[model samples]
Target: MAKSNILARTGNEAMAEAMRQVNPDVVAAYPITPATEIVQIFASFVADGLVDTEFVPVESEHSAMSACIGAASAGGRVMTGTSSQGLALMAEMLYIAAGLRLPIVLSDVNRALSSPINIHCDHSDTMMVRDSGWIQIFSENAQEAYDNMVQAVKIAEAVKLPVVVTTDGFIISHGMERIEILDDAEVKKFIGDYKPEHYLLNFEKPITVGALDLTDYYFEHKRQEIEAMKASTPVIIAVGSEFGKKTGRSYGLFEKYKMEDAEAVMIAMGSTAGTAKVKIDELRAKGLKAGLLKPRVFRPFPKEEIADALKGAKAVAVMDRSDSMNAQEGPLCLEVKAALYDKAANKPVLNYVYGLGGREIKPEDIGTVFDDLFEASKGKEKPGVSYLGVRE
Candidate 1:
């Protein structure tokens, strides 16, 4: 393993540190709560000459992304950071960026969407863009957040698509944790130099991008985009494997904690997975066959791997931190159910929407979900949607 520098830092700071190490050609960003520190710190790097990057302070998140798209189209390594409303404002540009196949890296600090006007940790922001063709990776803590940020650049460049490295807003963003960072030279060597095959600025091969494909070509273009998205799966795995080899930390599509022969399991993403791990340990010590499955990669869904992992579990509970507002189960739950639809096991699965607007989801709360899963396994109750840590 490569020698690493151990440091204590918040998720945003960690992400910014990784950005500094990568030293992209351009960074365009706007400040928002929780996610502000990431770009703010990076801007300081730009000003101090720590990195030779052009920092563009845009008026809004839309302009920030638009600038990044332009920079990326012109054959530059570009990145940015945003959260909640910032991401919502850049919704249209997100699809455009992905469709154009620009390898832009975005650090998305997860926060709840408005209406009640709350700014705290939740998966709503990312859930809204789940289908926008960006490779989404959820980090459980600062270490993972930092590691994912570095890996994202490599993954995006390899797939010629955008990548979103997400962490819970105030939960992981502001919370300090001990993390290991790769040496600056090592990171640069690993990321290598980005050389695009086709770009707007390539004088030898001039090409028009984002052209309006009205009828016959639009569908084919969309199909090509889907193929690119699917192609990202192997690239993600390859990058993650290479990262693990350099560092001692290995990552996969999802993490299975003590899932071997587990009769009851809990599936979740983001910071809550950390809490679930604690609950799983507690239940395991008490001789309960409990486990936790935390998905690091949300896009491309990892359907087959997830199905195979949960095959032996008699019951499963999918914990979603954001509600879809469809009056039904949340995004993660729906995907999990669909993945297991034709499986022979046909195990019972439940959905619990919790931790919205930064509500505390404690270890005890997770234990309760596992208890419910065990009960459902015994046919004591049918699997369904419910709320945790919420007032009815």
Candidate 2:
């Protein structure tokens, strides 16, 4: 029941310390910017016996995830970290781990997907793997990053599904902030030892893993994974509540700020939502009704909650950090619309795209955005998506 204080650290370091406190049996990874430090810190802990963890020095990201799949199949409490192309390299293995119901806990420091080779923050890296059957949760800060890493393990282990704790690349990964870290004993007790129902290394069981599935059972195997993902929603909220009781920090699938009696709202994800929240506060202080609905759980999208949150508003602005490249709508916006479809008299939705390739988004800009949308709601203007702080 003791709380510990640590000096301000980049979110990556806090995540590493949290992983160690959770005490995974195996920690295997190769260095990649933003996320490499997480594994390095744990590797040191393993080397110094600070943690009873096995260190696997894999040559590439592909092998990093492969190592996780192997350890997880054997029922070892396993963890790993990666970013951008590293995640893409481990892309194929992601589904493999999930398909086997490995219950692996991974952290993806969100980065821009490559082609022109962007190394900054965005959702493309993690978004690309959204359909890989992993329960994904996006964190807004270092504390949430640390907390979610621990909770991710609990969620994954509970549902027998793989889970990912994601945060913006440079936003949290590189920025330093003082964080209250949970004690190791509590982590051990909270996460508990991962007890697999079917461990591959169990000689008594001798169960087959990753076996070739014919059409007869292929759908069944995949269906179970999907079912596991759906089951994770309740588990995610439960674990988050436990952490809140322990640390006094509460988070939800979708969190709204200043939405009450507001005529307009901005729904977004990642760190920008926090920025928007602050601006919303300032606007509300000036007597403007502006609210923000920040989606913490990106996968298995929180449809019912979102619809209810934006129900009475005249307008809702959905901000996405990454574009669909050429899609009709940004990923989050399109999903929000679908989440609201079939509802009666919903608000007009505006889809805005920003922060691609690490474009800076300031809070004052959000205020201007609200002014624009508020006017549009009055029939004196029009609502449409525009890049905030993007060069023409």
Candidate 3:
């Protein structure tokens, strides 16, 4: 398989390719930093007829998401994006997009949620909406950002769920990287076409959507949503394999690195995890048993796979990109603890909250965090949820 130069582009540009490849019927969004490039490139495609899609210029991010909800409910393959406060603005409608099963794919260029405001990246933006019933796929680089967007559309449309192709805001979104974007004929053949299970705009078989489900059935519908999420785990893997076969780009929900004999491991999701792997390699060279567990599918949580992956570890460290305010544990950390709590002979889990508010997370900083976690494992002192790249 020859890897051709598919144009070296930023994360935002790659996302445009995704929107183009998915060929959504409607692309609705307002510009926000980090995520704005997605719609910018996509809008150009609409104007040039590169994509046969409706481009809606809205007043605000809220309207952008609302438009998506409306378009998706109307059975259109809808795409949109937002970052930081922009995503927060779209919070309410996001849940509506999912409960109503609209299958919209939005790029959430991960930026810090503000108050002492900043324009950088963090998971707080996405973690704030964790329970909104969206399947979140975090990308390690521009390539994953692009590839995942294509897969996200397929996966979201398949499970009748909304998907967010997330990456660190300025980190991955702004940084330039060389990536091989998959061609249309290849992606089209593999991803197939978008066919809605319950389209609101189908004139031939018009039916009620978003009808208020009474207490009697609301819980049941939500329960079904839970089942649908569980179903996505296998479906994403199967579909991802199919994508790899088509484009020579294979992927997993959680990227496992050197875990075969790892005694003490680290787990993280999204862009920072990529840097963590570099640190793990350095530790391995020093004869330390360090490894990384980078979760690709964040929403479903991938419990079974995660438990099995960390099976042999003596200590596990979870690196969280976002911090939950006043919560006893971070969302991902809480979930990891829950996953291993039931098992016997399990190792202690450590969590370090790093890279908040778009703070720079250098490869060595990641290494230092792991060294602290590893020190805790060896009784070198410091342990438990240390916040990295933060000034005391």
Q: Per-residue lDDT tens digits of candidate 2, residues 258-353?
A: 878888899878788889988988888998888888899987678888888888788888888888877567888888898888576556778888
Each model's C-alpha lDDT? Answer: 0.94, 0.85, 0.84
Arrange candidates, best lDDT first: 1, 2, 3
Query: What are the RMSDs of all candidates, in order?
Result: 0.9, 1.5, 1.6
Per-residue error for 106 in candidate 2, Å, reads 0.9
Among these predicted structures, which one has the highest TM-score?
1
lDDT of 1 by residue, 186-301 (tens): 99999999999998889999999888899979989889989998888888888889999999888889899999989999999999999988888889899999998999999878
Q: What's each prediction's TM-score?
A: 0.99, 0.96, 0.96
Clashing pairs in 1: none
Q: Candidate 3 residues 79-106, lDDT tens each?
A: 9988989999999988888888778999
